[model samples]
Target: MMPQQDQPANPAPLGLMAFGMTTVLLSLINLNIVDATLEKSFVLTMALFFGGIVQLIAGGIAFKRGDTFAATAFSAYGSFWESLAFYWVLNSEPIGLAPAASARATASFMIMWGIFTFLMWILTFKHSWNLVWIFGTLWMTFFLLAAHALRGTEILLRAAGYFGLVCGILAIWASFCILFFEHTGVELPGASRPL
Candidate 1:
């Protein structure tokens, strides 16, 4: 009797993860560019609202695929940011005596997100150090800095911006890796390497 041959597993889930990461990176890049170049409230609002929506959707799909930590973290924070941006868009005015009230609100949100990221880091500790975790950690750091920046701190804002840039670059690189694998069946050398 001939030996049974093993079958290859579906690659769709991995592809989805890659796609989600890519979208996130692109959105981050867009936001960063707006911050660095235009510095307009409108641009920031649009980026946050639209990007948050994308992240929410991607996170939802990831959740369905059993990436519980990623799903919850992304979906929760994405929704929070988007909703906050929408609130500001509709209100168009700061609340009372908060010293850039909008900034304070943002800071609070970031602090919450940072806490979630820490949880995610703990959950994923057993996993290998890869682009996903690296970006995840960077995302958490951005939130931490954002929290500080919202307290009228310029240094924190600068630090957050630098970290955001790094996150964006990693996201873009991860996206290209997926695109490459999808099209040409080639793999990168690290965590995203082909099985």
Candidate 2:
């Protein structure tokens, strides 16, 4: 008799997958904004640069492991601005221009991601509506707030800080869900440390 072959288990629900990917993507995105907005501080610069790279790498690894949704989410945002950062560094003459351009870019990126998240949430409804959807929608609001804050609006800045903190907390919670509930044999690429 032929030996039986083991099939890969079905992946997590779309909502859960989207939740994990979005959380990771948004966290890194927020850090990028903070890096551009904050004054010239070495510690912050090194932290953001290295941290963002780590997150991007993790996202790539996750994608390789079959988390296509998250992999794309993390890698797309990671590469998008990281490439921009490199360009900005290479063309260093326009000092003031870089920050402004970064802000605008971040804003545009956030808006697009927000829309993407919404669409993902809608698709997730086909699976089941749950806390994941509720929190996901609320979480996307932070992106809108961050986009406004990057535009130099004081109120939006405050809102962004508040919302960003909330998003971070929610992300940690989602990570725990993936860590505890999902039984994928492979370890999550970025679970070892903060990204």
Candidate 3:
């Protein structure tokens, strides 16, 4: 038999860290803890670079590693970030697409994303508790934020922001787990083995 090709280094940690840090920053704004002044571009920059572009690149690497789940998750969420940034730009004064989408439209977007997250969360059961919790809490965050937008309720948004913050923390922890495992060959408590 021919020799197997050498495998590339793990890229999931980079993907997870990108998504996690971006989620935390946005959650802070959603929780109204950040200044509105940075709302215009700071978020957009992260969305396009770290969240969108880098995540997508990591997803492609996962695909090369034959990890369909990682490929899907990274790519989908990367697209989500890109689409979100595009939406913001489309409605901004510079572009003026269609007079900005309504809160209901945004709610619909979140609901769709919630459904997607729940579906993916179901697939995480065999992976690890960390994986399950990450996607599971993310599912709730999306639905809760959607509910708030649809109903024009502030409380749900706050609740969703807190939930998203938790998801981010979990993601960051998982990322560190992968990176540490690669370095020291020790698995972190709740995280799964690297893909």
* Top TM-score model: 3
What is the total number of backbone clashes in candidate 2?
A: 0
**TM per model?**
0.62, 0.51, 0.92
Deviation of model 3 at 148, angstroms: 1.3
Among the numbered candidates, top lDDT falls to 3
Q: Could you give candidate 3's per-residue lDDT for residues 1-195 as a string of tens digits?
A: 221478666778899998998888888887888865565689888988898998999999999989999999999999999999888888788788857668889889999999999999988987877788899899999999899888878888889989999898898898998888777888789876223
lDDT of 2: 0.48
Per-residue lDDT for 60-170 in model 2, tens only?
665656766556655654554466456445445555444445676667766766676666555444332333443464446647554674766655655554554455455
Q: Ranking under lDDT, best-scoring first?
A: 3, 1, 2
Residue-by-residue lDDT tens digits, candidate 1, 1-195: 221255232232343343344334434443454444332364445447544665677577666657666577567656755765565455554543233446666677667767766666565545433455554746666585666656656555556655655555554565556556666777754434222
Q: Which pairs of residues collide in model 3?
A: none
Quote the lDDT for 7 in model 1: 27
Model 1 off-target regions past 4 Å?
Answer: 1-42, 45-50, 91-105, 126-128, 132-140, 143-147, 189-195
